[model samples]
Target: DKGELKGAGFSFQVSDAQKYGQAIGHIGKLTSGSLKVGDAVQADVDQARRQRIRLNHSATHLMHAALRQVLGTHVAQKGSLVNDKALRFDFSHFEAMKPEEIRAVEDLVNAQIRRNLPIETNIMDIDAARESGAMALFGEKYDDRVRVLSMGDFSTELCGGTHASRT
Candidate 1:
């Protein structure tokens, strides 16, 4: 959500924020504005950019699951970046991925994509989410309530991002 502050300062909204803070509900960077606390907000969306990001984000999850399947359960995601062009994933691995291992991961992700698995989302207590076997990123903070994203029976993780209804 975004909006302009109606005043002499002429504050304009630049972009929406993702993660919430303790004091700030939504923290967005301003391009040219002098916004203050208690400013009213409105939803502003760029449909095309959002669509591309969604695709990349969902692909990141798929790749995460495929990595575990092909590599090992010890594989833990270190970080990830998703943009309109691609999704870059960094993970903890003992050694460089072998060619066959990389190909196997690709094949697994492709097979799931071909299946067109239904994407399911549910809001639940954080503890319940963990009990449900949802994979969560280490060091990431979670509230009492969390959103769980499950890709068919293939992947289940804690995420708060746009995703397609199907794989």
Candidate 2:
């Protein structure tokens, strides 16, 4: 991916480095952070990192709830990785959904901002969830038990994430 970014730079507005060598500067200056692509380094994640992780985790719940309301009950949280930056949600659907469907999902998600639903998370048995009609993803591997997160009746899913007090 770094190479891909570098290649794009060669064809874009910043094509010639020598042309503006005096006026502009090195290409690295245009980028963010001091960590280059191949640097042998790692960033330590402390308690501050955990708080950021929690915010991202909670936002994911909001988004998941929104998608199900807009899409369908069939929609399930396929997988997720949340951090300070943003939420990446994957769902269960055989084929790629239409643009209208994607937009509707996004719109419904934003609309939740108006409803202030509180997030409630609890650990329970997977069999109990299935008995209660709690939806699970298509190919999710699970143990005998799982965590249930309920954001009003607006969203109820089996998730393991930091929840918001809104519930």
Candidate 3:
């Protein structure tokens, strides 16, 4: 997904011996500079790379649901990141998962994938989504309007990321 170098991450109070500027500017916005605000920035992503990432991203969601079902309802995703090579997921748990539990989660996910459940995306009120028992990431802030992704009746979550059309 790497594209043009649209902006730089700069810190004015760096520990280095010298300072480049007195103020820091945000991407697509002017913090304190002569540059005009709302500068148009365009980025092009490699389609093949994007496809791989999307596959991994969608898998991450299924894995989360599988973990919750295998481990316990207390399972909550702490963090996650997916790339072409791997999908890393962190969740809340007191102890390491047993081998059998891990295998069960894997089998469950494989079965779901084989079923080819259609992935549904919809925009709805955050409160309504919550009322329907859709799992929301703990401690994450959400606005009144949110995107909900449902992988059939297996998993439904409030997500804004891109996902595959089917499992």
Candidate 4:
């Protein structure tokens, strides 16, 4: 009940950010603090960690494109996790990927990475984005206005995630 700030170096650790209706909320854990109504606080992001996350997120997009090229156009992103350390991508496929197929996907992504292609982002109407050939994740909900990210001609998708300036 008391608005007491404890600990010599108390800080709020934000774990997740979500949108609820028109408002955005950050859910987190407080080390030692009693945050009541109207408690003002400052937020800061770790730039280096954020950079790593961006790199991983961009890599995920590139990998998705490579998978579709190597496998088939039927390949679609099922799920994905992008973090500072690594990226895990799940997709739809008829069968397990062969070793050579894996290598080909890796090679394609690596070649694009070597090129250091610049990443471009645009916000447009959903229909316009789709008409421009931006791939959207199946069964995923999107706003009327969407963010389309493209990396040269290698990859283009509807994404709101942070990304590196170049592959």
Question: Quick one: best TM-score, which candidate?
Answer: 4
TM-score, predicted candidate 4 vs. hidden true structure: 0.85
Candidate 2: tens digits of C-alpha lDDT, residues 1-167: 01112332232122222225237332323343333556553322244556666767776777776677666667777688776567787777666878987898777766664577777777789989877666677777977878888777766777755666663
Give the Å error, residue 72, model 3.
0.7
Question: Which candidate order results from sorting by lDDT in descending order?
Answer: 4, 1, 3, 2
In model 4, what is the error at residue 4, expressed in angstroms?
Answer: 17
lDDT of 2 at 158: 77
Shift in Å, residue 76, candidate 3:
0.4
Tens digit per residue, CA lDDT, model 4, 138-159: 8889999999999999999999
TM-score of 3: 0.76
Q: What C-alpha RMSD separates each model from the true structure?
A: 3.6, 13.0, 8.0, 4.4
Cα shift from native, residue 92, model 3 (Å):
1.0
- Candidate 1, residues 74-99, lDDT tens digits: the string is 99999998877788999999999999
For model 2, the stretches where C-alpha displacement exceeds 4 angstroms are 1-48, 94-99
Clashing pairs in 2: 118-166, 118-167, 119-167
Candidate with maximal lDDT: 4
**TM-score per model over all chains:** 0.79, 0.58, 0.76, 0.85
lDDT of 1 at 49: 75
